[model samples]
Target: MVDQWKAPSAAEPAVGDDKSWKLLEKTLLAGVQEQRRARRWGIFFKVLTFCYLITVLVLFTPLLDMERTAVSGSGYTALIDVRGVIADKEEASADNLVTSLQAAFEDPKVKGVVLRINSPGGSPVQSGYVYDEIRRLRGLHPDTKVYAVISDLGASGAYYIASAADEIYADKASLVGSIGVTAAGFGFVGAMDKLGIQRRAYTSGEHKAFLDPFEPEKPDETKFWQGVLNVTHEQFIASVKQGRGDRLKDKEHPELFSGLVWTGQQALPLGLIDGLGNASSVARDVIGAKELVDFTVQESTFDRFSKKLGASVAQQLAMWMGFQGPTLR
Candidate 1:
C-alpha cells in the first residue's frame, strides 16, 4: 500500500523529454553554423581564383610583347593593321593608327611602314584624322615610306585613309573605292500612325529634331540633310584628290565618286589603286624588307573585356534610338 500511488507533479516534464529536445536544438544550430561556414569558404575560394587568373594574365602579357619585339630584330618593315570599322573607339581608329604610325616612324630599325587595310569603312571624321596624321608623319620621316595594302575590302573611309599613303596596293580581287558620305536611319512615323500613336518630341530649335525617325518627313529638312551629306562628300573627294595627286581618272569616269565599289584590277586602270599585291609582296619587293614586324596598337585583354562589359551596351542603345551622324560608307 505504501509503494502505490503518489501522483506525478504537473510542473515536471516526462522523463528524458527535456534532454532529448535540448540535444535536437543543439544539433540543428550546429548544422546551420556549419553550412554558413561552408558558404563563406566557397565565396572566398572563388574570389581567390579570379584574382589569380587576372594576375597571371597581367604578368605574362608584357613578356609576350617583349618576345615579339626581340623577334623583330634590327631592320624590318613596320606593319600597322587597319582592320574593321574606322570609328573612334575601334581597332582601326585614328588614335590607334596615329600611335602605331608614330611608333613605327620614330624607330630607326623600321625601314618602311605598311598599312594593311581590310574594312568596309566607318566614320568620316576618324578617317580624316588618320589621314592628316599620316601626312604629318610622312613629312617628319621622309625616309620611311608609308604604303597601304588593301586586302579583302577597302571602301569609303578606308579608301580615304589609303589615299593618304605614298602608294596604294591591293589584291586583284579586293574590293576598293566608295568615296561617298551617307546618313541612314529608320522612319517610325508611318508605323506609329498605323498603330494610332502620336509622337510628342520637344526641342529648343525647329530643325533640331528634323532627323528624328518618329517624326514625319519634311521636304525642307530632307533637302538640308542632303546638303550636309553633299558637303561631306565634297570634302572626302577633295582629300582623295589631294592625296592621289592627279592619279584619279575622274574625267573618264564621272561615276567614280558615285559610291560605286570596284575590284582591284578595275581600280588600277581607273587609278584607284597604284599596283596589285599583298602585304608580304609589298614588304619584300617594294619596301626591300622581307622581315615584317607588326607595329599595330593592340588593346590589352582586360581593357577589351571592360569595354565590352560597359560601353557596348550604351553604343547599341544609341544606335537603336536612331541617333547617328554622317558615315563614309
Candidate 2:
C-alpha cells in the first residue's frame, strides 16, 4: 500500500487515465464541427431569403417591365390619374401631375395623353399651376392631343385643370363641374362664453387674428373675405370661358359658374363636357391605342407607411402653420 501511494510515472500514465483524456478531446472537436455546420446553414438560408424578397419586389413594381407595359411599335396612350385633393404636397399635387404629364407627352410612342380625374377639389393655386403647365405642354407638343376623362366626379379645382385639356369626356352619369371658390372656418367665441373660458392670443397686425375661431365675429372681416371669394370665383369663370370659348352655352345657363354641379348629360349641352366615354373606350376608339400606359406618379410603399406612422405629428405641424387660404373646394 505504501508503494502504491507513489506518484504516477512521467514516461507512461495509467491505461484508464490516458483513455479518458483521448475521449474528452474527441468530443470537444466533434462539438466544434457541429457548431460550424449550423452556422453555415443559417447564413445560407438568410441570404436565400433576402434574394427571394428582392425578386418579389421587383416583379411587383412597374419599373420591372416598363418597356413592355408602356410602349410598343404600335404606339400607346398615356394616362395620368388626377385623384383625391389637389394640394401642394399631396399625391395629386401640381408638381407630380405636371411632371407625369410632361413625361407622357414627351414620349414619342405615346400618341395621345389622357387626364383621368376623380376628385372633389382642393387648393386653387395648385390647380392653377397644373392647368397652366398642361396648356404650355400642349403648345409645345401640338401633334399630341390631351383629353380629360372624368370618372364618377370631377368638380371644383378638378374642373379647373380639366378645362385646359383639348377635350373633356365623362361618363353619362358623372358629376362634371363645380367651378367655384370658397374658404371655411369656425367661430368658437359663443362656445367659449358658454363654457366660461377666456381666450388669449397676441399678433403683430391688428387684422392678423381676424380669422381666429375663438374671437368674436367681425362684420368687416366677413365682408372682406366674401369679396376675396368673389374675386377668385371670377377668375375661375374667366379661365373656363377662355378654355371653352364658343362651345359653352352661356345664354341657356346663367348659373353655370355659380358653384353649380351638373351631370355629364347636362354638362354636354352646357359645354362643360364634350362627350360621354370611359377611358378604355376612349383609348381604343378615340386615340386608336389598344394598349394603355398609366403615367401617374405613385408614392413609394415606405413613404405611405411613414405617413401613416407620423399622422399625429403632421397634424401638429399643420396647426403651427396658420391661415392656409385661397382653397377652391
Candidate 3:
C-alpha cells in the first residue's frame, strides 16, 4: 500500500453517507405513519362516543313518558312530586304540576293523586295558577281525590298549592304555612357611592326606574310598592280561604297571614293541614291504594345535564346583579 501511495476513492464515503440518509428517511416515514394511524383512531373513538350518547338520550326520552302510561291493572296511587321552588322553569313549576295532575286524573287506574311536597315556596302567580287548576280538575274528576303530603317544608307558595288539595297532611316536625307576598332586592346605592361608580340610566316614564337599586329609594315609590305587595297578599288570603273553606280555624288570626311558618302539629289546630302523615301512609291508609306510581314530568337527560352545567352560574350572576321581583316566599 505504501508503495502504491493512492488516495481512498471519494465514492466510498458517498456510498456510506447515502445509506445513512436512506435509513433516517425510512425511520421518519415510519414515525409519520404511526402518528397518522393514532390520529385516525382518536377521531374514530370520539365519533363512537358521540353516537353512543345520542343513542342513550333517544332511548331514555320515551321511557319517561312510558312511566305515565305503564299503570297497573290494580288501581295505584299517582304520586306527583312538588320538590323545590314552585316557579316557572323549576322542577316543581305550575306547568309540570298541572300536566302531572291532568295525567293522573285522566288515567282510570289512578285511584287517588298525591302531591309529595318538599319546598320553601316561590312565585305567587305560579302557585295561584296551580291552585286554580287543581280545583278545576277536582270538579272534572270528583272520584279521583287529590291529597298533599308535606315532607320537610311547605310554606308560602307551597302552602298555597297544598291548600287546593282535597286534604293536606304532613309529618309532625314538617314546616307549613307562609300566607304572604314579598319582593326583595339589594340596594346598591351605598356600594356604588363607596366605589365612586355613577349609574346613568335613561328612561321615559317618571316611575320607570323606581325599583332601580343604584338610585336612592323614594318614599312615594316605596309606598306604591308596598301597596302592590298588600294587594298580592290579599289575593293570596282570598285563595287560601276558598281552598280551605271553614277548615281554617281562625281566619283573622294576626300572625296566621303574617308569613309565619309553623310545624305540622301546630298547623293542624290552625286548620292548615288535616292530619300528620307522609306520602306512603296517605297512599296506603288514606287513599286505600297501596301501590304507587309516579306521574311527575321529568326533565330530559340532556336538558338536566345542561341545566346542572349552567344553572348555578346563572343564579349567582342574577344575585350579584340584584335582578329580583316579587316572590311568594
Candidate 4:
C-alpha cells in the first residue's frame, strides 16, 4: 500500500511520462479531427436540406412555371388529374383541384383543359365546390373547352364534377356515374344491450347527440336525417339534369339517377357521358391537341413530412388499441 502511494525516483518514468503524453496528444488530436469531420458533415446536410426545401417551395409556387413557360410549346392540352376520393385533406380535395384547374386554364399555350378523373367519389360539399369552379371558369374562358375523361371509376361526387364540364368522355368499360348522396354508419345500442354494457354521453343541446350510435334511434330524428339526404339527392339530380339538358333522355330511363352506376358505353344513351374515349383520344381527336401538359398540384414535401409525423403518433395509438390499421378495399 505504501509503495502504491510512494513517489517515483528521478530515473523512474512518471505515471504520465513523455510516451504517455504523446499517446494522450494523439487521442486528443484524433478526437478533434473526428469532431471537425462531423461538423463538416452536419454543415453539408444542412445545405442539402436547404436546397431540397427550396426546390419544394419552387414547385408549389409560380416561379417554376414562370421559368418553364418561356420554353413550353404552344397549343398543348392542359391535363389536371382528379384521382382518389374527393374530400377534405385528400389529394383530390376541392382546393387542390380548383388551384390546378385555374393554373391549367390560365396558361396561354394551353388550347383546352382535360380533367382526368378516376375516383370512387366522396364529400358532396367538396365535389360541389369543384363543380361550381368549373362552371365559373367556363364562363370566364368560353373558347377554352373543358373535358372530363374518366378512367376506371368516376362515381357519385366524381360524376358531379364531370356533369359541370363541357363534355364527358370515358372508356367503353369505364364505370361512369353513380348519381346519389348517402350517409351511413353502424348503430351500437342493440349490441351494447346484449353485452350488458352501459354507454354514457353528455350534451348541452338536445340535437347535439341526435345521431349518437350508442343510443336508440329516434324515429323523428331518423325522418329528419333522411329528409336531409333526400334534399341533397334532389340537388344532385337537378345538377345532372341542368348540365345534360336536352341530351338527357331521363324520362325513358328513370332508373339512371336512382343511385345505380352505369358503364361509359351504357351511359352514352342515358347522356351521362358524351362518348366512349380515353384522355389520349380526347386530347388527340376532340381537343385537336396532341401534346399534354399536367397541371396537377402535388402535395408539398413539408405537407407529407408533417402528415407522416401525425400518422406515426396515430399508428402508435391504434396499435395500443389492438387495431391492425386500415386496408384499402
Q: Report the error of model 1 at residue 82, Å.
A: 1.0
Give the Å shift of residue 21 in candidate 1: 2.7
lDDT of candidate 2 over 1-329, digit per residue (tens): 35565666888787598789989999999999999999999999968855664564466644534544536767999988999999988879998898899888878889898899999979999999998998899999998988999998999999999999899999989998888888888888889999999998989987998878998878999899899999988888888888888898877887888888999998998899899998888898889986888778865532333356387753453344341222210
* Candidate 1 wrongly placed segments (more than 4 Å): 1-11, 47-51, 301-329
Q: Give the per-residue lDDT of model 4 (tens digit) for 130-241.
A: 9999999999999999999999999999999998999999998999778888889999988898999998887898889999989989999999999999999999989888
Question: 1 or 4: which has the higher lDDT?
Answer: 1
Give the root-mean-square deviation of each candidate in angstroms.
6.7, 9.5, 7.4, 8.1
Could you give candidate 3's per-residue lDDT for residues 199-294 as a string of tens digits? 999999999998898999999999999999999999999898888989997545668888999999999999999999999999999999987888
Instruction: Name model 4 segments beyond 4 Å from true.
Output: 1-73, 300-329
- Colliding residue pairs in candidate 1: none
lDDT score for residue 97 of model 2: 93
- Report the alpha-carbon TM-score of model 1 versus the true structure: 0.84
Candidate 1 has its poorest 10 consecutive residues by lDDT at: 320-329
RMSD from true fold, candidate 3? 7.4
The TM-score leader among the candidates is: 1
Displacement of the residue 22 alpha carbon in candidate 2, Å = 26
